[model samples]
Target: MTDPQVEPAPTRALPLVIAPPRGRQKPPRHLADLSAEERAAAAAELGEPAFRVKQVAHHYFGRLERDPANMTDLPAKNRDAIASALLPKLLDPVRTMEADQGTTRKTLWRLFDGALVESVLMRYPERATICVSSQAGCAMACPFCATGQGGLQRNMSTAEIIDQVVDGASAMANGLVPGGPGRLSNVVFMGMGEPMANYKAVIGAIRRMVAPAPDGLGMSARNITLSTVGLVPRIKQLTDEGIPVTLAVSLHAPDDELRDELVPINTHFKVAETVEAAWEYAKKSKRRVSIEYAMMRDINDQAWRADLLGDVLNAYGDWNWVHVNLIPLNPTDSGPMLNGQVFTRSRSDDMREFVRRLEAKGISTTIRDTRGDEINAACGQLAATE
Candidate 1:
């Protein structure tokens, strides 16, 4: 595959906010935010018996019930009080749009502070997956991403993050989605914000997700996929955390020169360094790291670039440690920051050639299925409009 004679797009300067701004009011506390010991202490503080908290946990985490009115086993008099203190609503659904005959639902949620975020629930024959947001908006300033176009509002609390999953689970269990009563089988942190940026809260949410049914969701860590835009330090930290969640690095470009413009954070952490961290993570966790490359018409979709990407990943030895997932660029109207540039999805032939180049180097690759296109299923599109 020869390099095509295509002129590179001119780079433009955009403001980037790597760190979230300070002094934003935190979201209300919820039971999902606390440990078992903390929940019992909270129950005692609320003038309820310790066992009451356990029962509530069973309802929330086990039964996927959020309304105090539905908790019939608890004493009716204390249900409201206990619910008010521990199960305060974190996400208020502003709007829900469905696609694929209602099997895919994208929800726009407003937090307590009125900051907007979005999540998506998709059902398949074999499994159900929910893509949850970790923050209100994004700070990465990835030029083509809708979430990054709107700067970071604030970091979401752990409970706020967990509520998205819980709500999705409730929807599935209640048969609200197209499939009749089913359980959520997987979760992906690929919506709205960078999961690694909100490290503490994201980790807390994962802990609650993998804990036992009475205390947490009891979902397998392998079922959760955490995506990052190559935050090297956080990737290393996650590798050391001993949690075996799948890691996905949003590596839009194989070279630092292009990545610096596509992903502003690349200016600090080069492509080699970021890939190294992901490689190290795969080695330690014994889990394959997914290389997420968004195919943009001619910008980063050249056949030569695909070969370069293969070389880059194979440099660390092709022990099946990495797999490439090519995402078709979702359509978004060009905003001011884009300098009147519109990124189009790659042509099917070009994409095929790109895949061929990678496969030639023995790199495992798969093209991601783009779902809910009519509902603007891509992260931050609905929230940004709202």
Candidate 2:
């Protein structure tokens, strides 16, 4: 088959190397970064009317439809063309595993490029949430995470990220779908890649998600979250964007020495500075910042460390904005602490007692619920070793 023509992606001119590696790596390109104008141009070239671009946008971004047969607004002649133009089969279900009484679903998508990525659709009585990935393989080598162990294959484009949510949203709305028809209430970038690593595409995808129907995906800005392993500079950048979405900092440890090995980037910006920066975002955005701390047994979970965490947070008590999600570590095949995260001694009893200490210190705290444990739900785990 002749190579199909598609719109050329905008060039960053800045090369894709995060750290100058010994060898070459391909420049990252994912389809989510394109603006509506670019998508319209692409559609026009495919003989789709310029207006149908809006319809396609409505379907993918607004209506969140994948099946062309369901796109009733277009002429039957154009449905196939429009569908082929924008919603090219980015991900087809390789498999879906459900647990938590069918309320939680984990889907492994085989991308058109043959890359695999995972998204989770979890349901609660109040709202359903979709945890989506912006990259196929993560560049960050956070040891505890299954995805990090694999190293970075590449960043997923904007469409790749948005598609995961759109599909989930559609499933909820269509009722004929997998997780049942209900609008998605939350979208989180706590998946595979360091979202900041795929910065532009990730931001573009966010705009698409929150933009109104016929313009973008039409989900509320408040329902989105972009978690990072404390990328200090990007955290500042996200604050400047003023999107009002939640900012989650994966600060696995409150101290730098461990984070340097656990999160790596923290070596450049230590825990204190990262928390300060997060305070800045919270102050400006007026939204609470979430500190994602994965509690490893005998690791960072000690009562003293938790007390120190409270001390650090208390330093910035002015913002009225911060919470800790102490995630209990999920054991992996690698030796413990190879990820350089999860302290060597969490003293579960002490750690649980410590949350009381932090709260006594007036720091907001909660232990996060673990999901998708049965089906290797950890990011990059399924794609790893494949």
Question: Which number leads on TM-score?
Answer: 1
Which stretches in model 2 have alpha-carbon errors above 4 Å? 1-33, 176-180, 332-334, 337-348
Off by over 4 Å in 1: 1-14, 332-341
Per-residue CA lDDT of model 1 for 1-386, tens digit only, reads 00000111213345777678898877888999998789888988998889899899999999999999999988988879888899998889899999889988889999998999988899989999999999888888787777787788999999999999999999999999886999999999988888999999999999999998888999999999999999999999999999999999989999998898788999989999999999999999999999988888878899999989999999995599999988877754443323344577788898899989999999999877777767778887777667
Q: Pick by lDDT: which candidate is best?
A: 1
Q: Residue-wise lDDT of candidate 2 within 124-224, one digit each (tens)?
A: 77887888887776666665566665566667777778889878887788773344577788888877778887888899889988877766767788888
lDDT against true structure, model 2: 0.71
Clashing pairs in 1: none
lDDT of each: 0.85, 0.71
